[model samples]
Target: MTRDDLAGMLGEQTTACGPARDALMAGGDFVVWDGPVPAGQLARTYRMRLRRTQRRGQPTLALAATVDRLLEAEEELLRIGQIVAADSSWTFMLFLNAAATEVLACTGVARIGTCPWTWCA
Candidate 1:
């Protein structure tokens, strides 16, 4: 889906967890990977990445929390994507279905140092 389309889906609501919808609205690079990513793969991938980040001494609390949320709602998400700030100061990982009907969850993490995900860099 287009950026504006994703923004429209996020609407004007502010979420208590992760980044607010405004982050996506503010603009950035957006890319989505098509998925139904097996069953537990999504959470597994994030967990592995979080662990790797932890090994390097990067703060991973936000991402870890996000991963937990992903585990809770893993079945509903069919695709995954990210929005990196224009200045590359932060990123928001978006979990949703391919059809773009809903955004199941999102998490924002500061890009204080090298991000494990190259796309966020």
Candidate 2:
């Protein structure tokens, strides 16, 4: 999927530091590698290198937790894809429900205002 597609999936306007977008940029890098035998089951491995920010004071941490949520959401999407392959009648609705469930369950902040990503930005 394209950067726009991933942004839409996450329900956020993909930030400048987004892993998908970074992977597409010139000389940019983002990757997820399989963990070694020892930590394989419990570890979710990912690496992303973003440009250094030149902000005026201490930069607040943002999106670290969100990344984990998105990863879980991705796994849910894969499962839904397999189900859709087997039974296509209710594909659209099933996919939508799966996506919504994943996003809601993984969201760190409570739903009180706008999208939590807005706060991160």
lDDT for model 2: 0.25
Screening candidate 1 with a backbone cut-off below 3 angstroms (N, C-alpha, C), the clashing residue pairs are none
After superposing candidate 2, which stretches have Cα over 4 Å from the reference? 1-23, 36-61, 64-121
The TM-score obtained by model 1 is 0.68
lDDT of 2 by residue, 37-110 (tens): 21111113211211111132222223344344444455333211111112111111011232232212111111
- For candidate 1, lDDT tens digit of each residue in 35-107? 6563257788878777766766654325666677678766664677778777777777777765657766566
Q: Give the whole-model CA lDDT for all candidates, comma-separated.
A: 0.63, 0.25
For candidate 2, which ten residues in a row score worst on lDDT? Answer: 85-94
TM-score of each: 0.68, 0.22
CA displacement after TM-score superposition, residue 104 of candidate 2 (Å): 12
